[model samples]
Target: MLGRGSMLVSSLFPLGVSGRRAGVLALLVWALVACRRAPEVSSDEVGEESSPAVLTIDAMDNEQHVLRGGFSVEAGVFRVELYEGSVLLGEALLEEGRWSIPWQPGVGSEFLEVVAYAMAGTEIRTRLDFQRLSFTEPEGLYAAEALLALPTEPDITTRYTLDGTAPGPSSPVYTTPLVLLNKRGQPAPLSLIPTNPDTSPETWRWKPPATPPVLATVVRLQRFSGETPVGPAEARTYLIGQGATSLPVLSLVTDAEHFFGHDQGIYVPGRMHDPSPEGTAGWGTGNYMQDGKEWERPVHVEWFEETGAPVFAQNAGVRIHGSGSAALPQKSLRLYAKEDYGPESFQADFFPGHPLRDFKRLLVRTSGQDQQNSKLKDCVLQGLLRETRLALQACRPTVVFLNGEYWGLHEVRERYDEYSLASHHGLNRKKVVILEGDGLLDTGEAEDAIPYAELLAYVREHDLSVPEHFAHVEARIDVEDFIDYHVAQLYFGNEDWPENNIKFWRHRGGSATPGAGDGRWRWLMYDLDAAFARGAEANSLGRLLRDERMAEPFVVLFRGLMTSPGFRERFVARFHWHLDNTFAPERVLARLDATVELLAPEMPQHIARWRYPESEASWRDEVQRLRDTLARRPEVMRRLLQEELGSP
Candidate 1:
């Protein structure tokens, strides 16, 4: 489940979670152990016509923009998909017996058929669960709530509570129009109350579950759909006022099944100040801050129904909106940044089809120190804030990430101040976002780290996760070579799959050159590559031990860059030294096979370019075409290593 940036869904379970996905290869150079649990879904759950597995939502019923999407079945059961008509989408694998169909769309309201079909003990059956909905918004509709209506299926129940929790009856523990922070940490306007709290007041005594809480405990609140409370809203308000002083950490459970599993957080239109043709928007003032780190000026808090902020009260749970039976993993509704990399490669390496997508929740990260507790502040500043937001904004994203240098110590402070200004403006978290200082850096160096520490401290003192990208840019160019490489890998890999290399650099490091924003392509290759290699040593890929993929293109570049023939020899000598010094040459040679496939076909391109009357094949178009061809027939990579090394 782990990828270069985060773990995949299937990788969540331990191998021993079940004996089914266990085994090992002798070479010991293993791939990943994907966790898959097959759920034995009943036909009624899927709303089938005859069998146990049925089509819950038909084409006409559910309108979706795209036909293709990935799905996660219940862990371990290996539910099989029995398709009667219409494609279920991408490569459907049957690991551990559950069927997962990638999203594939056919016409608007076509007769798309799907059934649960998995393999178990030689038996296969069709299985399916919730169906999908196709929604088309009317012209000029600018807000989320405009198009999102309460789900009509009585079996479906939808309630909005920003606290990260599941749904249930009596979950509406607050007065109607509950105001709690949504995922973006913005206040969502939603509250519920019991009809007769004075008489049946004990019913409002709901509590939250303990563990990696979905949201801040003090910010937690719970709500749901059911009979409205009979008592006065003020009576319940008094109860809420009293309970807020001593409630446990909050968890909100909501009936997500009724709402197309949509956002249980806040949504605001016209809250954005800057919008560009690039689809990138600039977040000015009034944007939500994570928590107590917010500006000391005591900013005003507003609760919009579609989105909002949780009422922060120490010792009291925030708010909880419990999702009904169909609740998906909370992880699905978060967001993150895989932006900023070295220029080693121009292309980005990330899982296609968006990673942090289909989020039904968005909460703002806690800002500064008033964050309920010190531990909570660290979690918010360190990562929990950034990752959670990234998980929620999952889509074909084009974001403006704060890249470049540490801009120096004082500069970050200036930028942080601007960040404060943006928060007071009421900008929702989704638009005009900032990648924190740590997330942008990759090395544990003092230069890179100190600025982030300052940023984090400021957030704690002020309670905001966002630093001023524009201001921090003044920190200037201080890209760690290692930082550059990770930024580069993240840029080139195209998919953030788990990396098995000896040196795996993560971005929670330090300050960097501020101006080195995501826009600077050249900075990504050379600067980032060096940053990535900064910490690399012993067995890590380097100049001397070139993988074929690295060698092919590199040979040309190496030759091009070498000041003299001795330079080439010195390079080769260093490479051999890596083999001789660290790894067994033969073993290293054998293991370095993935490189071969990359270079094989490119050899001809190189030869053709070399043989070109002058610069014929060396032309940019030709080089690009060659690269594209290689990318398409990447298996040609195998030929590269074999032919170059001759181990076969």
Candidate 2:
């Protein structure tokens, strides 16, 4: 009879281990039989209510006696069970309010659940109480080495991959704690340089870096039940005493196939190809042209501040970014946050003096057209003009790590869109209208382009010397904003503009948020990499006054506005104010020197990684050239202002 009862208990609830399966069942059956055979004591005789008795877990220690814990209850037999995420680990019956089961947990086992139930006077052993416990968090950057101790469980196997790949049965088995150490060394001198000094990136030839990058151990661990994986894989990156950097660091981890595989990889030349016009080699046609959600890949992003303390680590989506630069060796990537990936917003203060902390999208930029030049031109120009009325993308230079390999320097910038405007100026995103070069609608509805088209027509038909005619144009666009925008671009000698890279926005709704909701157009400053490339004495203002390349509407608007005395006076005054303050030789050179100092430490490894500017010496020469341009630009612009506006 006892054997039959024990068999029933074993069949009903099996303890996870095969050896303890019979033992746990027999113990529970004995406890039940003892409760039944003993004389029944009434609730009144025990001086307790007829209601069910409460159970309390007093002590638990898996290390001391395999798996054991003490419980207290009102005069009744009880049974206990321990579980690791629904997998039954052990079961036992109480002996003098204490129970013990033969079980041992794996390393890094931080959480567990224990359940208690009455064994007597219950149709079946129903759980009356349960408690969950947490030990310690087990993922972070370590100074020396990390002991990667994974949990050990029966039947469930633990596997891991050190190359940032997903773990499977064929991967290395985690039997003991792994002792991981840093494998970083000083970067070797750049042996390979771009052979053609005057060729474009599309026709340029180069090879991957010959030397390996600074190293970190990225362990991706997964537990398996039979052949199926249990839950998501766990990952941790160990820096292992890497040297600190003055700039922040970004570690991006993803599957190797997603980044380097021939057919699917975005970085490689892959299947698609376009023969270069020069016919030397194909320039711009490739798999990198792929865009949209279909091309977006999953990635784990970890950010560490300049001081080496981690800020945020989360999963996000990434896609190739930029126009022509997308085809470069180190491509720019646009990162997105969505519910499908993880969080919907990256919460952090990315730029100094910026109030908003939530960002929906960001750019991991390779400095666009300036990737091979100073690489600081775009960032420096934008930073100088941030106080102006024009909207601009904020930039923060950071070094990146792909898997465990160094990816070199890249800027983390805010992506411009309706969301960006809404965040910065507190306007309704749906009501914002953004148009690019020549009235092409970049954001909002197609109908949003109508107002700009009408404004262009109005400027072309009427003479802006008439006060009413100029007022009509002023009502449609913020004239002061236009002045500031033109001053900054013209001062920087950005030759790409008035025709290319032009962007403007306005609120479609009524006034609600001060200057932002006034339904007047405002300009955005970006892609100033072409700035300061021309000599300091370049006559950008004179070129804008009468250039055949300028579109009809832009030419008509600028020439027409200059005809008005009031408009000319305001533009001259604004230009002088900026030249004295924003573009002062001392102020501009100070910012340039500070930026160079910040990048000096990382430029060696970065130059070796990309082989750009040929060598560190050439890069420094380019930076010095830029410094000379800025130092002389203010004086040159004042002379040009007299040439264009005549004795302001």
Write the residue-wise lDDT of candidate 2 on 521-638 in tens digits.
9998888878966789989998889777777766677787999899999999999999999999999999999999999899988888777756789899999999899999999999
TM-score on alpha carbons, each prediction: 0.19, 0.74
* lDDT at 305, model 1: 14
Q: For residue 274, give model 2's deviation from the true position in Å.
A: 6.2
lDDT of 1 by residue, 414-484 (tens): 11111222233332322222322133433234354354345334333431112343223213223233233
Query: What is candidate 1's local distance difference test score?
Result: 0.23
RMSD of candidates 1 onward, in order: 27.7, 19.2
Q: Which window of ten consecutive residues has the lowest lDDT sum in model 1? A: 404-413
